[model samples]
Target: MLNLPKEKVIFAGYATFFMISLTKTTNNRLKDKLKTKSYTTRGG
Candidate 1:
């Protein structure tokens, strides 16, 4: 009962952070893929 509200609040906070973190992680993944492709093409 009481725990439900707290859980919801905590979930909301984490959800907000997750949205930002997800974008960062996605960008990092794309950068990593580009690096890999460049390295393969350059034979390095």
Candidate 2:
């Protein structure tokens, strides 16, 4: 019984970490896209 609860907690923590990292990665991609588009429009 103790092990079961511990396992669930670990899984939840890993899932949370994964989601946070994924969001950060997506945000970076969006930022890069916007920068490139702006540069191209500016003829830089």
Candidate 3:
């Protein structure tokens, strides 16, 4: 087992969670944009 300080561990956990959430939101935005583009193209 690797020993780490408590603060460092918590920071790492928060950082990882933040990054995952950021990526998820970014992906969702991209998907939304693609969907809108498709809809407009179909309607036009």
Candidate 4:
């Protein structure tokens, strides 16, 4: 029973870390995509 809470805490920590990294990479990809789209629009 005592180990259960400890396991939950560890799981939550990893979840938070994974979410943060996922968002960071996705945000960068969005920015790059937008930049290229805008540049192409302006050039054409």
Ranking by TM-score: 2, 3, 4, 1
**Model 3 residue 16 lDDT?**
100
TM for every model, in the order presented, reads 0.63, 0.93, 0.89, 0.83
Where model 2 places Cα greater than 4 Å from the true spot, the runs are: none
Judging by TM-score against the true structure, name the best candidate.
Answer: 2
**lDDT tens digits, residues 1-44, model 2?**
89999999999999999999999999999999999999999996
- Give the lDDT ranking, best first: 4, 2, 1, 3
Q: Candidate 1 at residue 8, lDDT?
A: 100
Of the two candidates 3 and 4, the one with more favorable TM-score, higher being better, is 3
Sequence-dependent TM-score of model 2: 0.93
Model 2 lDDT, full chain set: 0.99
TM-score of 4: 0.83
What are the lDDT scores of the predictions, listed in order? 0.98, 0.99, 0.95, 1.00
Better structure of 2 and 4 per TM-score: 2
Deviating ranges (above 4 Å) for candidate 1: 1-12
The worst-scoring run of ten residues by lDDT in candidate 2 lies at: 35-44
Quick one: best lDDT, which candidate? 4
